[model samples]
Target: MDGYQVYRDAMTKDQWQGWWVTWPLSTRVRLGHVYDRKSDGVRRAGDLAARGIPFQREHGTPDGTFIYDSNESVDVAFKASGKTPAALSALTEADAGASVTFTRGRTAFVVFREYSQSGISDVRGLSHALVSAWWNKEWDDSLLAVTSVVAAAGATVLTAAEGGAVAELKVSASAGVGELGMADLALGASVVRHSALGAQWTGTDVTPFYQVIRLRKNWLGKIVAEYGPRPPGRGALPSALPPLLSEEIGDDPEAALEPGDRTEELPFHDPENE
Candidate 1:
């Protein structure tokens, strides 16, 4: 699992592109990155709305702990299930149809159409620098997937596998002491496992991940969720961007359908579907 090997165990070659979203029991963060007690509740949301950016929203519990699923994919189990295309949603290698379903502890909230610039490619190939960081951080069990670097001149694009895996981060010399750069980050946030519905399913938190996913490149540049009204406490997540990137994600201004604010009966990958 250290060196370059077939990604067969991680994803389906037939469907090289696809993602899923799920919400797990809220994470308990000690030294948090995204969520903290000091931030405004509706600030991020309001900004997105004001900017006219499209996003998905859902209702939460009494404490305002509404769960949100960002850009997600399921390339592994789909192939194993031998399922064909139906209403495949989310982003895919072929088209823009989405699958809907629910799981234990959480329900399908909604899925908004993803918006991103074109010309971006998925990153392929492997490097020891990436693996060593993850393994040393005790994160060898997770899937390792790579994506193409978009717009970034000097960086590499690496995304986690469908089930999700933890990987290392690389930093540049110009990176500051506590900068978001790889070396400064050293060991970043934990990479938790996701359920079929995209919930954080891994029993405990895995090693900190080092990938950097830009907001311009992501569904949202910044994420704000109401875990529990009482400052649910911020938790760790994957890095903000991939390793060694050097540019911003361009705005494509492409017109697409809205994914909507709720999920449907997702075709859970099963033997029958296969």
Candidate 2:
């Protein structure tokens, strides 16, 4: 850890330094694109996004909705499962600041970074949001976000208690959930730079898989607000909650749903947290 250093992908114009020299105090920060998984760098900071999770991974930002490769110089291949011409057109042909959303079985995954029509970039603090838009293609070349909308019918998109983990949401092969979970989901969004009018970014990212765990209930409300709307109440949500980053404890979210010790509701039912 002695000689540890970090860098960023310079904006398309500035080339004074190869991310080696430090910039001024007010200089904006951009998350480094570490292409090496085993290189002891950032988490999920490379190419070939992790796969085999319950939910799907789609490309394109929450806006534009068109899938594109952000890997200007990486080896990752993030895949975009389903796409419609509408989603793609919104990104390529639509106006900047225009936004769309990608939903996985009623759950909101990633919102796209706002951009101008010319792709001039309004990436002030929108990095991870951009990753949510990756369609497992090569740098902005192979991937394209399709603007197709698949209905979520016949699939098992259920929710259990309020403000807690998604106890159960099973999808039968005979009854597919209309392209649900088809996009790679990401978390830990931080505005890397407010350097420009529209340019923002989130440097860190990880492909989260579904796991049965207790949710803090509204823990993510404020964060979600920064991007868009949130679940109306803690009782139930259209989309199941994402897995927690770690095992945590707090009042049982279900207690408020009913009117008892509610402690019976529990930190978690699966015995793992028992």
Candidate 3:
């Protein structure tokens, strides 16, 4: 059946308070459930956790709906459904938020968020990129799509319309690859924009900012090359700098990189300066 049909059936199902579907990764889909009460949802999720089932709890909706989602295969979900009092289901639908149409080969999903014309255009472009990445099995490009959306939205957390990819990105970030990749993409995009502005740039030259980004990017590259993707084992990913470094950098590149920073004088000078 088509994605819309699956979505309609899930939404109309009587067993769960609410239901939705998402693509945690291009290759896998997750089924999500909403409950009428937090306690019921928490208890059910806790039971799953105790049984070593993989699931993720999302923030409550505006109406106090508690959410829990899992990426288990259809057979597994059905088998596990009896373990808990709640009925479990496989992710049979494409992301409802995206309203995606899944045909034989191509998939197109919509994002339902209010945005200006420019914002809409940006999201549409990134959505196309995401679709292309999915079709081509380009995991890095898929990751890039997620980061680009975050950059475009200027937020760490994604909107409901963009929630489909959150779980997978979180898993990747936990593994260290996601965060490093995001940093690289953001820095690269900033450098490109800065270069495009050229002398027309106002405020601080931000040449220092470019240097910092490059140093960090190069360091990240080295780390990847050394460790190969992620470290050997699981747990918190290693960081070259302390958490305070992120605080110092803050979110704004302009504010983070002031003039006359020590790194500005480092051997790697800006190409424009050379």
Q: Please, what are the lDDT tens digits per residue for candidate 1 over residues 149-224?
A: 1111121112322333322222222332332322121122221222232222212221111111111212221211
- In order of listing, the candidates' clash counts read 31, 42, 1
lDDT of 3 by residue, 1-274 (tens): 3433332233224422222221111111112111111221111111212322233333221311111111211111011111222222222222111111122111111111111111112322323322222223331210111110111111011212122221111111122222232212111111111111101101110211011111133433443464445322223332232234333334332331122222112122112223
TM-score to true structure, per model: 0.16, 0.14, 0.15
lDDT of each: 0.21, 0.21, 0.20
Candidate 3, TM-score vs. the true structure? Answer: 0.15
lDDT of 3 at 263: 17
The local lDDT score (0 to 100) that residue 93 gets in candidate 2 is 20
> lDDT of candidate 1?
0.21
Model 2 residue 257 lDDT score = 18
Candidate 1: stretches off by over 4 Å: 1-18, 24-114, 117-127, 134-138, 143-274
* Each model's Cα RMSD: 24.8, 25.3, 25.8
